[model samples]
Target: MAIKYKVLPRKNPRDIAAPEKFYAAAIADGDVDLDRLAELISYQCTVTATDCYAVLHSLEHNIIGELEQGRIVKLGRLGNFQVGISSEGKDTATEVTTTNIVKSRILFRPGKRLRSMLNGLTFKKAG
Candidate 1:
């Protein structure tokens, strides 16, 4: 049996124009209403405004909660995020032991499928 695969046109940062431009053009074209356009974009992008905000909130809470307890949180296929201490003033090279002096950062690790897809495809410039 032949393997079936869906081929999506690769889009580069340069290939994409400003969202405002596209939105304006779409509105001018009258192909859809504002609400319909919003819904279409949301569905195609796998996220809506509400969903994005919720996800951001969840991530912030999870990371902060873990760090407060001195634990590294590992998001599957998205890497390990951690909070670590740093000293201020002249002793910038050393880590501070105090809980009050720490920095938080989010780390990401791409999944195998995502990595493979990235490696396998080459983006072509749209004329």
Candidate 2:
């Protein structure tokens, strides 16, 4: 017995680049406000504009706080964010964890789907 296979059409990033161009033009022309732009981007990820902004704001604050503490912060599967230290001396930096010079780092554990996506085994190309 013989089996037949068909190639499925995929939308490459390049294929969708025009939409990005249009979005940029719209924003540059002031056709859409910041809230609308946020909404458009959020829509791509199936999330609400408020939720998207909240996530972005949270990440910004968390990163800033981590850097202020003089410690490396790692968000599992996402990647590590480190703040550079001056060569002057470590003593000048405030420790993230009190009572000890060594600061305790913060780690964000990735959710199940994110973890699986990072592992790169769950996805298969269509044929």
Candidate 3:
């Protein structure tokens, strides 16, 4: 199925007074949460919906645990999950410490299969 997108007008960031340009932004048709995902997966495999849900739930839990331990979690064909940090610079290396660490965020890097899927996507203007 072709992805849907809508034209959106955005001003140039470097020059706020510049005329706006229109761009196509993709839109999601809907969301399929964990429960729905389990059912869909069960259809493709022998696992029951409940069992699949349990495994998915556990996977989510374990991924968080791994990330908290300062390790990257790599799920084949899915992606890699890791923690990223933004920090304030110190005048000297000796002055640098955890206090300089401003913020942290979870980052996802899509694996090869996901990247290929993204590259193959076809789009259509939204109705």
Candidate 4:
């Protein structure tokens, strides 16, 4: 199946006076929830749906725990996830601390296998 996209017109974000431009944005057909994911895994393996759900639930908890502790989590072929921060600048190096941090974000670096999947992906315009 091809990835679907829609042509959308958007104003220049940097300058409002600038002319609007049309860009191709991805259009998601649907989303698979956690339960559906577990069911799929169960179908592919000998594990029961309930057992698969338990494993997935545990994995979600652990991933969050590792991230909150300032650790980079590597999920095999899926990729690596790490905590990233945006902070206000401080005049002195010593003046900067956790309080200056504006927000923390999760960064993902796709593994080789997952990144390579993009190479063969095809795109189609949304209906």
| Candidate 2 residue 67 C-alpha distance from true site, Å | 1.8
State the weakest 10-residue window (summed lDDT) of model 4. 29-38
lDDT of 1 by residue, 1-127 (tens): 2222333444356756534222111112125544565566677787895665566667778778887787878777755666554545445545445654555444445656656765664343222
What is every candidate's alpha-carbon RMSD to the true fold? 13.6, 15.9, 1.8, 1.4
Q: Which stretches of candidate 2 lie over 4 Å from their true place?
A: 1-41, 88-127
lDDT of each: 0.55, 0.57, 0.95, 0.95
What are the runs in model 1 whose C-alpha is more than 4 Å off? 1-47, 86-127
Model 3 RMSD in Å is 1.8
Counted clashes in each candidate structure? 1, 0, 0, 0
Candidate 4 structure quality by residue, lDDT tens digits, 3-116: 999999999889999999999999998999779999999999999989999999999999999999999999998999999999999899999999999998999999998899
The better candidate by TM-score, 1 or 4, is 4
User: Over all chains combined, what TM-score does candidate 4 have?
Assistant: 0.91
Candidate 3 lDDT over 79-122, as tens digits, reads 99999999998889999899899999999999888889988889
TM per candidate comes to 0.35, 0.35, 0.87, 0.91
**Backbone clashes in model 4:** 0
lDDT of 4 at 127: 88
In candidate 4, the residue pairs with backbone N, CA or C atoms under 3 Å apart (3 or more residues apart, or in different chains) clash, namely: none
